[model samples]
Target: MKPKNIGIQMTDKALLFINGVPPENLPDTINYSLIACSDGAFHYLKEKGFPLEKLDFISGDFDSHSGKDETIYHEKFIFTPDQNKTDFEKSLEIIKERGYKEVDVYGGSGGEMDHFLGNLTVAFIFKDDLKITFFDDHSHYFFAPNILVLNDVKNKLISLYPFPKAENITTKGLKWSLIKENLEITNRIGTRNFAQENSVTIEFDTGNLVVFIGN
Candidate 1:
Protein backbone atom coordinates (compact mmCIF):
# COMPACT_ATOMS: atom_id res chain seq x y z
CA MET A 1 0.00 0.00 0.00
CA LYS A 2 1.15 3.50 -0.78
CA PRO A 3 1.32 6.28 1.77
CA LYS A 4 -1.61 8.70 1.90
CA ASN A 5 -1.39 11.44 -0.70
CA ILE A 6 1.23 9.66 -2.72
CA GLY A 7 0.89 12.55 -5.12
CA ILE A 8 2.57 14.72 -2.53
CA GLN A 9 5.62 12.46 -2.46
CA MET A 10 7.83 14.59 -4.61
CA THR A 11 11.53 15.44 -4.68
CA ASP A 12 14.06 12.61 -4.85
CA LYS A 13 16.44 14.53 -2.61
CA ALA A 14 17.43 13.20 0.82
CA LEU A 15 16.66 14.85 4.15
CA LEU A 16 19.35 14.34 6.77
CA PHE A 17 18.60 13.49 10.40
CA ILE A 18 20.81 13.78 13.46
CA ASN A 19 20.00 10.79 15.62
CA GLY A 20 22.37 8.44 17.49
CA VAL A 21 26.08 9.12 16.83
CA PRO A 22 26.47 10.86 13.49
CA PRO A 23 29.20 9.79 11.11
CA GLU A 24 32.16 12.11 10.58
CA ASN A 25 31.03 12.67 6.99
CA LEU A 26 28.34 15.00 8.35
CA PRO A 27 29.31 18.49 7.27
CA ASP A 28 28.95 21.82 8.97
CA THR A 29 26.31 22.67 6.41
CA ILE A 30 24.12 19.65 5.60
CA ASN A 31 23.13 21.47 2.29
CA TYR A 32 19.59 20.27 2.63
CA SER A 33 16.82 22.82 2.87
CA LEU A 34 15.56 21.50 6.22
CA ILE A 35 17.10 19.16 8.81
CA ALA A 36 15.66 17.27 11.76
CA CYS A 37 17.06 16.24 15.14
CA SER A 38 15.58 14.09 17.82
CA ASP A 39 14.73 15.74 21.14
CA GLY A 40 17.77 14.53 23.03
CA ALA A 41 19.84 15.01 19.89
CA PHE A 42 18.86 18.68 20.01
CA HIS A 43 20.63 18.93 23.34
CA TYR A 44 23.42 16.75 22.00
CA LEU A 45 24.06 19.14 19.11
CA LYS A 46 23.72 22.13 21.39
CA GLU A 47 26.42 20.77 23.68
CA LYS A 48 28.57 19.70 20.73
CA GLY A 49 28.49 23.19 19.16
CA PHE A 50 26.42 22.49 16.05
CA PRO A 51 25.01 25.68 14.53
CA LEU A 52 21.59 25.46 16.10
CA GLU A 53 20.28 27.94 13.54
CA LYS A 54 20.59 25.25 10.89
CA LEU A 55 18.21 23.00 12.76
CA ASP A 56 14.70 23.11 11.22
CA PHE A 57 12.92 20.83 13.60
CA ILE A 58 13.60 19.15 16.95
CA SER A 59 11.35 16.12 17.18
CA GLY A 60 10.40 13.55 19.84
CA ASP A 61 9.20 13.96 23.44
CA PHE A 62 9.75 17.48 24.78
CA ASP A 63 11.01 16.00 28.02
CA SER A 64 14.55 16.02 26.66
CA HIS A 65 14.81 19.79 26.87
CA SER A 66 16.84 21.13 29.79
CA GLY A 67 17.68 24.44 31.49
CA LYS A 68 18.06 27.66 29.45
CA ASP A 69 16.94 26.10 26.20
CA GLU A 70 18.21 27.74 23.02
CA THR A 71 15.57 27.24 20.33
CA ILE A 72 12.12 28.65 20.94
CA TYR A 73 10.89 25.69 18.91
CA HIS A 74 10.99 23.86 22.22
CA GLU A 75 8.19 26.16 23.28
CA LYS A 76 6.30 24.81 20.25
CA PHE A 77 8.44 21.85 19.23
CA ILE A 78 6.98 18.89 17.40
CA PHE A 79 6.37 17.05 20.62
CA THR A 80 5.26 13.42 20.28
CA PRO A 81 4.07 12.32 23.69
CA ASP A 82 3.59 8.69 22.71
CA GLN A 83 6.12 6.42 24.38
CA ASN A 84 5.56 3.38 22.17
CA LYS A 85 7.60 4.53 19.18
CA THR A 86 11.26 5.49 19.33
CA ASP A 87 12.08 9.17 18.84
CA PHE A 88 13.84 8.30 15.60
CA GLU A 89 10.67 6.65 14.41
CA LYS A 90 8.74 9.79 15.20
CA SER A 91 11.20 11.79 13.13
CA LEU A 92 10.81 9.36 10.23
CA GLU A 93 7.03 9.75 10.26
CA ILE A 94 7.35 13.50 10.08
CA ILE A 95 9.78 13.21 7.19
CA LYS A 96 7.47 10.92 5.29
CA GLU A 97 4.50 13.13 6.00
CA ARG A 98 6.44 16.04 4.54
CA GLY A 99 6.71 14.15 1.18
CA TYR A 100 10.38 13.30 1.22
CA LYS A 101 11.20 10.16 -0.77
CA GLU A 102 14.44 9.33 1.03
CA VAL A 103 15.89 10.00 4.47
CA ASP A 104 19.60 9.86 5.28
CA VAL A 105 19.89 8.70 8.89
CA TYR A 106 22.90 9.21 11.13
CA GLY A 107 23.73 8.86 14.83
CA GLY A 108 22.07 5.49 15.36
CA SER A 109 25.34 3.73 16.13
CA GLY A 110 28.47 3.89 18.28
CA GLY A 111 26.37 4.17 21.41
CA GLU A 112 23.88 2.03 23.28
CA MET A 113 23.39 -1.35 21.63
CA ASP A 114 19.63 -1.08 22.01
CA HIS A 115 19.61 2.34 20.39
CA PHE A 116 21.67 1.08 17.48
CA LEU A 117 19.46 -1.95 16.94
CA GLY A 118 16.30 0.04 17.40
CA ASN A 119 17.50 2.54 14.85
CA LEU A 120 18.17 -0.30 12.43
CA THR A 121 14.63 -1.57 12.94
CA VAL A 122 13.24 1.72 11.65
CA ALA A 123 14.50 0.77 8.21
CA PHE A 124 12.45 -2.43 8.25
CA ILE A 125 9.39 -0.63 9.54
CA PHE A 126 9.26 1.65 6.49
CA LYS A 127 11.13 -0.54 4.02
CA ASP A 128 8.22 -0.98 1.64
CA ASP A 129 7.54 2.71 1.31
CA LEU A 130 10.53 4.94 2.05
CA LYS A 131 14.13 4.74 0.91
CA ILE A 132 15.84 4.95 4.32
CA THR A 133 19.53 4.29 4.89
CA PHE A 134 21.41 4.32 8.17
CA PHE A 135 24.98 5.55 8.20
CA ASP A 136 27.59 4.46 10.69
CA ASP A 137 31.28 5.18 10.79
CA HIS A 138 31.95 2.23 8.51
CA SER A 139 29.02 1.21 6.31
CA HIS A 140 25.73 2.32 4.77
CA TYR A 141 22.88 0.12 5.97
CA PHE A 142 19.95 -0.64 3.64
CA PHE A 143 16.78 -2.01 5.23
CA ALA A 144 14.71 -2.92 2.20
CA PRO A 145 13.44 -6.21 0.76
CA ASN A 146 13.19 -5.08 -2.84
CA ILE A 147 14.86 -5.93 -6.13
CA LEU A 148 18.47 -5.18 -5.20
CA VAL A 149 20.66 -3.78 -7.95
CA LEU A 150 23.62 -1.98 -6.48
CA ASN A 151 26.14 -0.30 -8.82
CA ASP A 152 29.73 0.65 -8.15
CA VAL A 153 29.64 -1.62 -5.11
CA LYS A 154 31.67 -4.40 -6.59
CA ASN A 155 34.31 -6.07 -4.47
CA LYS A 156 32.72 -4.43 -1.42
CA LEU A 157 31.90 -6.38 1.71
CA ILE A 158 28.17 -6.89 2.21
CA SER A 159 26.02 -8.64 4.82
CA LEU A 160 22.34 -9.54 5.21
CA TYR A 161 20.14 -10.15 8.26
CA PRO A 162 16.56 -11.38 8.06
CA PHE A 163 13.76 -9.97 10.13
CA PRO A 164 11.91 -13.28 10.55
CA LYS A 165 12.09 -15.13 7.24
CA ALA A 166 13.47 -14.30 3.79
CA GLU A 167 12.76 -17.14 1.38
CA ASN A 168 13.90 -18.41 -2.07
CA ILE A 169 16.62 -15.80 -2.21
CA THR A 170 18.94 -15.59 -5.21
CA THR A 171 21.99 -13.47 -5.75
CA LYS A 172 24.36 -12.39 -8.50
CA GLY A 173 27.56 -10.34 -8.52
CA LEU A 174 28.45 -11.63 -5.11
CA LYS A 175 31.65 -13.46 -4.25
CA TRP A 176 29.37 -16.19 -2.85
CA SER A 177 25.97 -16.58 -4.55
CA LEU A 178 22.83 -18.17 -3.14
CA ILE A 179 20.89 -20.15 -5.74
CA LYS A 180 17.70 -20.51 -3.71
CA GLU A 181 18.39 -20.16 -0.03
CA ASN A 182 16.27 -19.51 3.01
CA LEU A 183 17.71 -16.70 5.10
CA GLU A 184 15.73 -16.75 8.30
CA ILE A 185 15.91 -15.20 11.72
CA THR A 186 17.03 -18.56 13.07
CA ASN A 187 19.83 -20.62 11.53
CA ARG A 188 21.19 -20.33 7.97
CA ILE A 189 22.45 -16.79 8.40
CA GLY A 190 23.75 -14.48 5.65
CA THR A 191 26.61 -12.19 6.56
CA ARG A 192 30.17 -11.29 5.64
CA ASN A 193 29.32 -11.61 1.96
CA PHE A 194 31.09 -9.63 -0.76
CA ALA A 195 29.97 -8.19 -4.07
CA GLN A 196 31.87 -9.53 -7.07
CA GLU A 197 30.75 -7.09 -9.78
CA ASN A 198 30.11 -3.42 -10.32
CA SER A 199 26.39 -4.09 -10.34
CA VAL A 200 25.22 -6.70 -7.86
CA THR A 201 21.72 -8.15 -7.82
CA ILE A 202 19.65 -9.93 -5.16
CA GLU A 203 16.10 -11.29 -5.57
CA PHE A 204 13.94 -12.85 -2.90
CA ASP A 205 10.46 -14.31 -3.29
CA THR A 206 9.26 -13.21 0.14
CA GLY A 207 10.17 -11.44 3.41
CA ASN A 208 12.28 -8.41 4.37
CA LEU A 209 16.04 -8.22 5.05
CA VAL A 210 18.69 -5.75 6.12
CA VAL A 211 21.56 -5.16 3.69
CA PHE A 212 24.70 -3.62 5.08
CA ILE A 213 27.37 -2.61 2.59
CA GLY A 214 30.75 -1.45 3.78
CA ASN A 215 31.77 2.05 2.79
Candidate 2:
Protein backbone atom coordinates (compact mmCIF):
# COMPACT_ATOMS: atom_id res chain seq x y z
CA MET A 1 0.00 0.00 0.00
CA LYS A 2 1.19 3.54 -0.73
CA PRO A 3 2.05 5.41 2.42
CA LYS A 4 -0.25 8.33 3.17
CA ASN A 5 1.37 11.75 3.49
CA ILE A 6 1.34 12.56 7.17
CA GLY A 7 3.00 15.05 9.53
CA ILE A 8 5.97 13.10 10.94
CA GLN A 9 6.92 14.90 14.15
CA MET A 10 10.19 13.97 15.83
CA THR A 11 11.21 15.03 19.30
CA ASP A 12 14.91 15.14 20.17
CA LYS A 13 16.28 14.29 23.57
CA ALA A 14 17.21 17.93 24.15
CA LEU A 15 15.85 21.13 22.58
CA LEU A 16 15.82 24.76 23.63
CA PHE A 17 12.13 25.16 22.77
CA ILE A 18 12.42 28.25 20.67
CA ASN A 19 9.28 30.29 20.06
CA GLY A 20 8.11 31.39 16.59
CA VAL A 21 10.51 28.98 14.88
CA PRO A 22 7.73 26.61 13.98
CA PRO A 23 5.17 28.89 12.39
CA GLU A 24 1.97 29.38 14.34
CA ASN A 25 0.03 28.44 11.21
CA LEU A 26 1.20 24.80 11.27
CA PRO A 27 -1.85 22.60 10.70
CA ASP A 28 -3.36 21.41 13.95
CA THR A 29 -5.32 18.46 12.63
CA ILE A 30 -2.37 16.63 11.11
CA ASN A 31 -2.18 13.06 9.83
CA TYR A 32 0.51 13.05 12.47
CA SER A 33 3.05 10.42 13.54
CA LEU A 34 5.22 11.17 16.53
CA ILE A 35 8.75 9.83 17.01
CA ALA A 36 9.88 10.48 20.54
CA CYS A 37 13.62 10.04 21.11
CA SER A 38 13.60 10.98 24.77
CA ASP A 39 11.06 10.68 27.53
CA GLY A 40 11.20 14.44 28.04
CA ALA A 41 9.93 15.04 24.51
CA PHE A 42 7.13 12.56 25.02
CA HIS A 43 6.08 14.42 28.13
CA TYR A 44 6.49 17.73 26.33
CA LEU A 45 4.01 16.69 23.66
CA LYS A 46 1.65 15.31 26.25
CA GLU A 47 1.79 18.64 28.04
CA LYS A 48 1.08 20.44 24.76
CA GLY A 49 -2.08 18.32 24.39
CA PHE A 50 -1.08 16.55 21.18
CA PRO A 51 -3.33 13.49 21.16
CA LEU A 52 -1.95 10.08 22.08
CA GLU A 53 -3.87 8.45 19.23
CA LYS A 54 -1.97 10.56 16.68
CA LEU A 55 1.30 8.97 17.74
CA ASP A 56 1.60 6.10 15.23
CA PHE A 57 4.93 4.78 16.50
CA ILE A 58 7.90 5.67 18.75
CA SER A 59 11.45 4.27 18.61
CA GLY A 60 14.61 4.80 20.64
CA ASP A 61 16.89 3.19 23.18
CA PHE A 62 15.21 3.19 26.56
CA ASP A 63 18.07 5.26 27.95
CA SER A 64 16.48 8.56 26.89
CA HIS A 65 12.90 7.37 27.27
CA SER A 66 12.89 5.97 30.79
CA GLY A 67 10.20 7.66 32.82
CA LYS A 68 6.67 7.23 34.17
CA ASP A 69 5.24 8.62 30.95
CA GLU A 70 7.14 5.97 29.01
CA THR A 71 4.68 3.41 30.29
CA ILE A 72 1.82 5.56 29.09
CA TYR A 73 3.09 5.38 25.49
CA HIS A 74 4.70 1.94 25.62
CA GLU A 75 1.96 0.30 23.55
CA LYS A 76 3.25 2.00 20.38
CA PHE A 77 6.94 1.71 21.00
CA ILE A 78 9.81 -0.01 19.17
CA PHE A 79 12.88 -0.41 21.33
CA THR A 80 16.07 -0.87 19.32
CA PRO A 81 19.00 -1.52 21.61
CA ASP A 82 21.55 -1.18 18.84
CA GLN A 83 23.82 1.82 19.33
CA ASN A 84 24.90 1.83 15.69
CA LYS A 85 22.05 4.13 14.62
CA THR A 86 20.56 7.19 16.25
CA ASP A 87 16.86 7.30 17.05
CA PHE A 88 16.31 9.90 14.35
CA GLU A 89 17.83 7.57 11.76
CA LYS A 90 15.74 4.61 12.91
CA SER A 91 12.57 6.72 12.75
CA LEU A 92 13.49 7.87 9.24
CA GLU A 93 13.90 4.29 8.08
CA ILE A 94 10.44 3.53 9.35
CA ILE A 95 9.04 6.44 7.36
CA LYS A 96 10.86 5.26 4.26
CA GLU A 97 9.63 1.66 4.72
CA ARG A 98 6.10 3.02 4.82
CA GLY A 99 6.89 4.85 1.52
CA TYR A 100 6.71 8.44 2.65
CA LYS A 101 8.17 10.79 0.04
CA GLU A 102 8.37 13.86 2.25
CA VAL A 103 9.04 14.54 5.91
CA ASP A 104 9.36 17.68 8.04
CA VAL A 105 11.46 17.13 11.15
CA TYR A 106 10.94 19.20 14.28
CA GLY A 107 12.96 19.27 17.48
CA GLY A 108 15.98 18.24 15.44
CA SER A 109 18.04 21.31 16.27
CA GLY A 110 19.12 22.72 19.64
CA GLY A 111 20.35 19.35 20.78
CA GLU A 112 23.76 17.79 21.17
CA MET A 113 26.15 18.56 18.29
CA ASP A 114 26.50 14.90 17.40
CA HIS A 115 22.75 14.40 17.22
CA PHE A 116 22.28 17.60 15.21
CA LEU A 117 24.93 16.53 12.72
CA GLY A 118 23.42 13.04 12.61
CA ASN A 119 20.02 14.48 11.70
CA LEU A 120 21.69 16.57 8.99
CA THR A 121 23.35 13.46 7.60
CA VAL A 122 19.95 11.80 7.30
CA ALA A 123 19.08 14.42 4.67
CA PHE A 124 22.05 13.37 2.54
CA ILE A 125 21.40 9.64 2.98
CA PHE A 126 17.77 9.87 1.77
CA LYS A 127 17.97 12.94 -0.45
CA ASP A 128 17.20 10.96 -3.61
CA ASP A 129 14.29 9.02 -2.13
CA LEU A 130 12.54 11.76 -0.16
CA LYS A 131 12.31 15.50 0.41
CA ILE A 132 13.61 15.76 3.97
CA THR A 133 13.56 19.13 5.70
CA PHE A 134 14.92 19.99 9.14
CA PHE A 135 12.81 22.77 10.55
CA ASP A 136 13.14 24.60 13.79
CA ASP A 137 10.97 27.67 14.44
CA HIS A 138 13.61 29.92 12.86
CA SER A 139 14.82 28.14 9.74
CA HIS A 140 14.39 25.31 7.23
CA TYR A 141 17.38 23.45 5.71
CA PHE A 142 17.80 20.93 2.89
CA PHE A 143 20.35 19.73 0.35
CA ALA A 144 20.34 20.31 -3.41
CA PRO A 145 22.68 18.80 -5.98
CA ASN A 146 21.32 19.76 -9.42
CA ILE A 147 18.99 22.56 -10.36
CA LEU A 148 17.02 24.18 -7.52
CA VAL A 149 14.02 26.40 -8.11
CA LEU A 150 12.86 28.78 -5.42
CA ASN A 151 9.36 30.22 -5.36
CA ASP A 152 8.34 33.80 -4.54
CA VAL A 153 8.65 34.40 -0.82
CA LYS A 154 9.62 37.80 0.51
CA ASN A 155 11.98 38.66 3.36
CA LYS A 156 13.53 35.22 3.47
CA LEU A 157 17.30 34.71 3.55
CA ILE A 158 18.86 31.99 1.39
CA SER A 159 22.37 30.55 1.76
CA LEU A 160 24.37 27.81 0.07
CA TYR A 161 27.17 25.79 1.66
CA PRO A 162 29.29 23.67 -0.62
CA PHE A 163 30.57 20.33 0.64
CA PRO A 164 34.28 19.40 0.70
CA LYS A 165 34.95 19.58 -3.05
CA ALA A 166 34.85 22.67 -5.25
CA GLU A 167 31.51 23.22 -7.04
CA ASN A 168 30.73 25.05 -10.27
CA ILE A 169 27.55 26.99 -9.51
CA THR A 170 25.31 29.56 -11.15
CA THR A 171 22.32 31.53 -9.95
CA LYS A 172 19.55 33.56 -11.56
CA GLY A 173 17.51 36.35 -9.95
CA LEU A 174 19.97 36.74 -7.12
CA LYS A 175 22.19 39.61 -5.91
CA TRP A 176 25.26 37.69 -7.05
CA SER A 177 25.56 35.28 -9.97
CA LEU A 178 28.20 32.56 -9.90
CA ILE A 179 28.26 32.18 -13.71
CA LYS A 180 30.39 29.04 -13.58
CA GLU A 181 32.40 30.03 -10.53
CA ASN A 182 34.23 27.38 -8.54
CA LEU A 183 33.00 27.46 -4.92
CA GLU A 184 35.23 25.79 -2.34
CA ILE A 185 34.22 24.70 1.12
CA THR A 186 36.45 27.41 2.57
CA ASN A 187 34.93 30.12 0.38
CA ARG A 188 32.06 32.34 1.45
CA ILE A 189 30.88 33.13 -2.11
CA GLY A 190 27.64 31.21 -1.64
CA THR A 191 26.74 32.82 1.64
CA ARG A 192 23.85 35.30 2.26
CA ASN A 193 22.51 35.59 -1.29
CA PHE A 194 18.97 36.95 -1.64
CA ALA A 195 16.16 36.67 -4.15
CA GLN A 196 15.92 39.75 -6.38
CA GLU A 197 12.82 38.62 -8.28
CA ASN A 198 9.82 36.41 -7.66
CA SER A 199 11.74 33.22 -8.34
CA VAL A 200 15.40 32.20 -7.87
CA THR A 201 17.13 29.44 -9.77
CA ILE A 202 20.39 27.74 -8.80
CA GLU A 203 22.47 25.20 -10.69
CA PHE A 204 25.46 23.27 -9.42
CA ASP A 205 27.74 21.09 -11.51
CA THR A 206 29.44 19.14 -8.73
CA GLY A 207 29.51 18.51 -4.94
CA ASN A 208 26.63 18.44 -2.45
CA LEU A 209 25.17 21.81 -1.45
CA VAL A 210 23.02 22.70 1.50
CA VAL A 211 20.44 25.44 0.95
CA PHE A 212 19.23 27.19 4.04
CA ILE A 213 16.14 29.38 3.71
CA GLY A 214 15.28 31.41 6.74
CA ASN A 215 13.52 34.59 7.86
Error of 1 at 159 (Å): 0.6
Overall lDDT per candidate, in order of appearance: 0.74, 0.63
> What is the C-alpha lDDT profile of model 2 across 1-215, one tens digit per residue?
32234455433211111111223333343343333333234555655665655566666666755566567777877776677866667777777776667666666666467666766776688888777776776677888758999887444678887755437688888777678777767755477877777788889888888888874
| Candidate 2 residue pairs in clash (backbone atoms < 3 Å) | 21-137, 21-138, 22-137
Candidate 1, 1-215: lDDT as tens digits? 23223345434444555557756656434335456788777766776777776666778766656555735555436878888988888888887887776777778787778888777777678776688877777888876555788889987898988877788888999998998888987787789999989998988888877888998
Please give the distance, in angstroms, between residue 123's alpha carbon in candidate 1 and its true position after superposition.
Answer: 2.7
The local distance difference test score of model 2 is: 0.63
For this target, which candidate reaches the highest TM-score against the unseen true structure? 1
Q: What is residue 149's positional error in candidate 2, in angstroms?
A: 0.8
User: What lDDT, from 0 to 1, does candidate 1 have?
Assistant: 0.74
- Model 2 scores a TM of 0.77
lDDT of 1 at 5: 31
